[model samples]
Target: MTKNELGIQAMQKGNFEEAAKYFSEAIEENPTDPLLYVNFGNLLAALNDHERAIRFFEKAIEIDSNTATAYYGAGTVSYNKNDFVKAKDFFEKAMKNGLESSDLFFMFGMTFIQLEQPRLALPYLQRAIELNEKDIDARFQYGLCLAQFGQMEEAKKELSIVVEQEPNHSDAYYNLGVAYAYEENIDKALSMFNKALDIQPDHLLAGNAKKLIEEAINR
Candidate 1:
């Protein structure tokens, strides 16, 4: 079997080590192919070997400077290292090239959040929701961003939708409980905590909230 085909098959099975080996052998056979570096970088990145991953990513960029995947890989590792400025720069470079998607935009928003730039996170997250309204995790993060920026009402709206769509989402209920508590709706807050506990009995926040609610009731 062709090395590239074997690499693809190995990757599909999550055997990244074998995939990398096959890709390396394929690279020896076809050194000019940029896709080989892409495959190798992806496998190394999956293994969390950031230094080697960046090397392969750099090779991909050298072969074709316009490949967005190379920039994205470098950006992701920088973000993983908590270098938000570098991460932002690489993500922007990727977007300027050919990378545009809800997931990428959401990642940019998340990087802004790490940089304590909630305002900047808003537009990216809003764009993500606009692009794909069905991304529940993105919706949750948007609500969290709103909450961080003191937009409690808006945050409640988004989180409430999560609860409505997925009644068993403990985090959604917990977030709603927090919002209600902030709004001075103690009864509603307690009810949300109860719902959260019902959904995930071992949830730390729900367990703590239940104790607090029972204490309040006893008082």
Candidate 2:
């Protein structure tokens, strides 16, 4: 088998040392193939070698200048390194180069959140939700972002949809309860928190919310 094929096989089998050796040999054999750099970069990233992974991705971009996946790989490494500004820069470049996926939008949104630009993140997350309404994580985070921006009514609507979709989702229940509380719907907030606790008996937030409800009731 060709070194490239062997590298791919080792990568799929989770044999990182073998994969890296084969990929390195492939790079020496065919230094011009962007796929070689990308594969090497991917394995390095999986190994948590973000700095080296970024270099490989940049090398791929230098070789093929137009491949969107290289930009995405760079962006992902930057994001994983918690460099939101750089991640955003690369993500925008990737998108401009024809990268399109709900996950991409969601990743950008998350990076924006890290940058404390949650308002700016909202549209991207909303698009992600539109692209894949079934993704509970996207909906749940989108709802929380809305509430963060004081868009309580809109947040309630999104959270309500999530609870409908997965009645036992503890985090959804907890976030939805927070949305209700923001809207001053105290009864609904208490009910949702109670349900969250029922789903996850050890959930600290749910237990705390339940205590708050009891205190309010006693008041």
The Cα local distance difference test for each model comes to 0.87, 0.89
RMSD of each: 2.4, 2.3
lDDT of 1 by residue, 1-219 (tens): 899889989998998878988998999999988878977887888889989988998998999998887888888888987889999998898889978888788888899989989889898888888998877777888998888778899999999888777778899999888888888898999888889988898989878976887788799
Question: Which candidate gets the maximum lDDT versus the true structure?
Answer: 2
TM-scores, each model vs. reference:
0.86, 0.87
